[model samples]
Target chain A: MKYGYYPGCSLEYTAKPYDLSCREVFKALQIELEEIEDWNCCGATMYMSQDTLTAYSVSARNLSIAEHQGCGEVCAPCSSCYTILRKTNRYVKWDPHARAMINDALSAADLSYTGGLEVRHPLDILVNTIGLNRIVDRCVRSLEGYRIAPYYGCQIVRPVYHFDDMDNPTTMDRLFKALGAEVVEDYPGKVRCCGGMLMMTFEDVALDLNADLLEGAVTRGANCIATVCPMCQMNLESYQPQINAKRHSNYRVPIVYFTQLLGLALGIEPKKLGLDDLLRPLPKLAPAKPMEGVK
Target chain B: MGISQSVSPPLESELRSAFWDHVQMIPDGHKVKTCLQCGTCSGACPVSHAMDITPRGIVALFRAGMIEDILKSRTIWICASCYSCTVRCPAGIRVTDTLYALKRLAMEKKIYPDKFPVYALSKAFTRNIRKYGRNFELGLGFHYFLKTKPSKLMSNAKFGMGMMKRGRLATRPHKIKNLWEVRAIIERAEKIGGGK
Candidate 1:
């Protein structure tokens, strides 16, 4: 399963866990993440917001790098990075004027993108590469009893450009079901932003918005929420305590990365699975005392 | 909307003010001033039928501080964050970002909406980041579904079964090796306030 892996800036700095864990998981699944040489930023949605052309050009530069590596599909672990790259690719291919401008911008960096490569998210790669049956076959311990929420943050499916179904994308839900957990059916904010940009500028907007989402989950009877995007992860996990404090509520739902649960069900030790690194310590699913059925 | 839009207003009272304060940080944040209300964004919207306020109206609600209604309305959940409004808006307003800003503000109010499934979705994403450092759709999806009520799980059974048949979903435990490095990274994220 060797492929071009672009971990983006966040994974390298703030979201290193995503990059490192992705490598670890792929290794176990016999998938390989060959880094694209001399990769650069995906514009962080910043360049795009400032200058749309620069955004397209920056993304093209990254795509051009992947092309140089002779890879057909470049897998991006960050949703922001994935969306930015995908959006830029689609624009250049779909709009000749924009393509010309982006191409000209790229030439300033002495790079040329031929628009033959595909940019994909890590979740897309996992499902496409491992296949559902392989994931099912690997799940010795089934999440048969847990009611899980399949979360797809704003960037994954929204805007309906060069992606899956805009409203109801089943990719995340499909992947979760194969892993032995029952996927919750509610349509809670799958494509909604978690105030990613505001989190940087305004504290109240980010924390309060996240609290509302958390409160909704508590009412929905979701014990665990699963997500494929890191920004959503950080927003929900970090904001919970603040929600509890300011709102004076006990919404103690655990915010976990979908991969951590996969590693756990696969019998990976808690430490190895990165269980201790959360805002609120992850609570035990059951009493420490041995359960009737749990090993 | 297969996905819900924001309810009425698009910003909270205090946060609405802050959006402008932060708007200064953004190079072109003032683009909001150009809205002509041609009704193009609302008319073109697939989910406009579901919103109490048109996409254009939602913006008006923001400026008016009729934000509480917007924050509590079902429309916030309906938003797909499609950015179609932004893309197609002749006014070039950051309508999608404003919508997201509304969701963030609404969530802070601790408003619980059960009809939409996004609550679970957001929670699952949050939990995934906390534990795995990344997302595993198969694992997280199952974890999310299993965590829900029995009847809710049944409603999801159809989709669950489809994953089984397609072999696109996992039915087994999938663990990654060398996860210790990932653990350290997560710890750092929290210590550095990536998680509150």
Candidate 2:
């Protein structure tokens, strides 16, 4: 299936690997990702804070562009952009006052909002479109001996009206398990904020909470942490050292995208998985030989 | 609608105005005015039992002009940013985002310390993600405990060792080959936020 793809600012910049891995995985799964022509930032954190109506207009402008391009869905890799855009669509559908204000703003950009189109997170496409049964059937390098901790972060499940189930989410788990990975489960301060841009605004507090969540996941026996949000991925991966330097300790855990792990199970090469591009190096996993000749 | 008239306390008057000040700064900021005081959010909150005041209760406090109590309560910090109320709100007030708005104000006001164990850990988690493209759990976990001087837990070394035996902890880190690139990315991100 083909999708209109919006990688957002972080993916275009800080989280390029998320964008790269997304293309690689979707290609392997036979999904065509047509990049939206002349796409700009979704106004992720700033517009939302300064002006709600304008935020809706800008986000809707992007969505309307995809619809104008005739794409049925706009698949976003960044959770911030996904949440903002989805929430904007949701708000405009019910509140006529908000709808009118945002539409008037959009008219300035030569755009309009008609909210039937779906705004999907790439994770949703990975689970819902690739279809778990197909994911299971395609598995080659099973994660049987490895322990994985799937972290949803806040934006993905939150504003729950826009995304999936807030509590007791199982989509990520089902995908991981299908790849032959042992799923590590627990209360992970789940649905907790990774402090988003707060990492920049309040560095100390953000790092502190990072330690709490990462430490708890490690103590719980997760060999690795997997996530779907680029902002969360970038935040948690970048901050571990300051945390270590402050205490004069060195703790290293590899944060990665689920697509990387799935790519491995699908027998894609490691370099293609962007494994070496990680902030932290991963431990040796006693690499499994891939199955020869799968259609 | 049936209504009863009573003396509107002065305490309520001051508090309500302040809450509106908070409301005005946010996107979809005025949803506070539409709050119906239903308790669905409090009911759905996973940690509501642990909160000094529940999510819906905070709205009641704001509406009643008792926001000083909100400023003082540990309830703001207790939020995981789960968005339970944001999803469930009849008015859709952006509950999680709004709490964060309060969090910024609370921090500036010194309403609470930044010393919560969870706070330290989360900060480190985000910092590391920025440094590397991903997380290195080994460095992150031990790094946090060392900084906090939660060394009192050192007596529990046997427990740590036992877990190590079970292959829970990796003594050796899996260093990514593109360390320079990782360093560059962190540098750029830092520049974007400006001196964090």
Candidate 3:
């Protein structure tokens, strides 16, 4: 399987581990990723708030680059990027006024975008397109005892019905089970918002949302939470200590990118997957020693 | 505070039509006029407790053209854009998108609550994008921390250091290769879209 990879800005800096582990997992799966050349920020929601046409134009520019590269399908690892790109692709295709306005900006750069590109999230590509059969065939180490809570933040499944249910998505759940981990069913935080854009600006609100998501998962006996979006991973992983301090709770859930777990299950070294690069150390998938009385 | 204190006399016809026109222009925002007042959006909002005005109230206010009455409240800034309200609205109102449109309109009117970090942070983010054609995390942090609210620097300093140590934060901006192209795009977009 081959794809045009659009690893948004976060994957390059804040979420480097996601990009690293994602590449390794795809390599193990024999998937090819061609990073789109000269990609710009997807403007997330902030840019859209400032100016809709400019935001659409910026998103269009990225698609135009991918289209120029002759890539019919472009995959973004970030949920916000995927949503924005997909929205632009769909908007420009259907809304002639928006299309003309965005094209006017594009024409200024000697670029005119004719939209037909398929914008996708990596999770969509992995579970839906690649098929679990291929993934199951490549898993060298079974995560038989590991308990993972799959957290898909708001964007991927909402507003646009791509490949999963909007309210209760199971792509990651099935993906994790395919890798041999115990999927935490009925996890309330499964489709919760991570307050991605507000993390920095509205710290209090963001922290509260993050705490709910972590608490929801850990209360369900999840060893750790597995996530697909960088914003979700970073928000949950980096703020657990602070959340614990404020709430006076002893929660130590290590948030890991789903790709990192996939890499581990595929027999990729921990170091290669950038496990140690996480703000919080990786939680053991299984206990180092058996409990004295539990069994 | 009850809703009556802020209510202005029914909005002038011209102003009411203008507001509706703007909302109707954005995709799916026309649903603003179709709000059922069922309070589904308010119930679905995770941060509604922090909001002074409920999400449903905001929609009602927009439809009523009493935006000035709603503008001062921190409700719009508090929205996490989670789409819970958008997805759950039985009327299919783009609650999230309408909120975003209201945010922009609020910013344009300079009515967002003073000293609110959301405005400052968004300003810093847009400034970074305009300067480099891409968001520079380090630049954004500095701009937001130093320029908007320096007090946050001391509190968030540890997280800042952690990001730097883990190589998650950059000290300098990362400019896109074809920056001129990006600039031209932004310039033309501003010229065309700003006319409104």
Candidate 4:
């Protein structure tokens, strides 16, 4: 299947690993990712908080570009991008005032969104569109030794999106299990906030939130936390030292993109998957074992 | 306490009624009036402890005709926009979106708490998007630290350097090829009221 890719800004910088691994995984699965040309930022929560119409107009520009490219659905790997874009889509569809304002704004650049462009998260696309059965057929390496805490973060599931259970999302859990990894079933901080850009604004509060997530994963015997959001990965992984120092605890847990693990399961090289970019190294995965019941 | 007592009842009621009308301007904001006084939003909020007024308290204060107090409090800036409360609210109040509206209102009125980095960060972030059509993380950090707490820049320099060494931090901004289109959209939106 072909999809338009919107990496957003973070994927171009701090979340480059997510971009790399997502490309590799999609390639292995033969899902073509056509990037929308000259896609601007999604106007994340920052712009949304300041100006409503401008934020929607900015985000809608990307949708307009995707629609121009004949892409019916655009996949955003970042949760913030996914949420913001989806929110824009929802408002444009339901709120007439927003629709008129956004379209009028878009008309300035000779672009307009006529609706029907789907804004999707990579996780939703992989687990739902690709399906687990097809994924199992492609797995060349088992994650038998990996105990993964699937950190869903906040955006993808919340605000009553029908993608997955907001409180207890199991798409990642199910995907990890299908790859032969043991899922941390009772991970309390699975859907918790990773403080987003608050890490830059309010370091102490963000650190505390990340600390809670790490402490939850570590206590659940998770060797690493698999995440779907760039901000969550950065906040939870990059802030471990500060969290350790501030919270008076030791935490060396590797926070990785779920796509990276999926890429590994698909037999992609670790380097190609951007595994080396991780601040904390993922524990070595044991060699693939014989299939128990599968062909 | 002193401020409310100083206002005559007629003027206070007028301000309170205006506040209610303003709340209705928010997207799905009318649902806020349906809040059952349940603290579900506060209980669900991960960072409510850091908020000067909890999520539920914002609604309660609105009921108490204290919109100014809510705007000046750190509650709106402290919202992480996690939307936990929005989803969990029994009354289906869009608490997070209300917070966003409050943030915009606070910014418009310049009524936020002083020395709050969230304002600086948001301003820096939006400015970066406007200038480059994408976030320039290094520049964003430089502007944020310079604005809110210049002293923290020294402590953060090492962290920034580490990110740079890891190939995660881009020294230069990534400007989109069609930045003019983004600029046009913003300018047009501004002319069209920008939902202000």
Model 4: lDDT equals 0.86
DockQ of each: 0.04, 0.08, 0.67, 0.76
- lDDT digits (tens) for residues A1-295 of candidate 4: 4588999999987998999999999989999899999999998999888877788899999999998898979999999999999989988888888789889999999999977788888898999999988988888877888999999999999876668998899999999998888999999998999888888878899999999999998998999999999999999988888989998998999999999999888889999888998889898776666434433
Error of 3 at A171 (Å): 0.5
lDDT of 1 by residue, A1-295 (tens): 3578888655553344455567666666777678876565565544333233444565577687788788888888778888878877777667676566556656555667777777887777777667776766655565655667777766777554445666567887776666656677774656555767444333455666677777666677777777777778767875666668888998777777677766655555566555664544455544222112331
Could you tell me the TM-score of chain A in candidate 1? Answer: 0.87
Ranking by DockQ: 4, 3, 2, 1
Ranking by lDDT: 4, 3, 2, 1
**Fraction of true A-B contacts recovered by candidate 2:** 0.10
Relative to the unseen true structure, what is the Cα RMSD of model 4? 2.1
lDDT of 3 by residue, B14-80 (tens): 4455455457657877767788999999998888988889998886776666677676678888888
Which tens-of-lDDT digit does each residue in A1-295 have in candidate 2? 4699987655653465677778888888778889876564565654443334444565676777787888888898788888888877776777776566666655554567777678898888888777877766666766766688788877788766443668667778888776767777774755566766555434566677677667767787887888888767766776777778765656587888877888778776767766766767556557684433322
Q: Which segments of candidate 2 are over 4 A away from where they belong?
A: A161-163, A187-189, A245-250, A290-295, B1-61, B64-94, B97-196
- The number of the candidate with the highest TM-score is 4
Q: TM-score of A-chain in each prediction?
A: 0.87, 0.92, 0.94, 0.97
Error of 1 at B177 (Å): 29
Best by DockQ: 4
TM-score of 4: 0.95
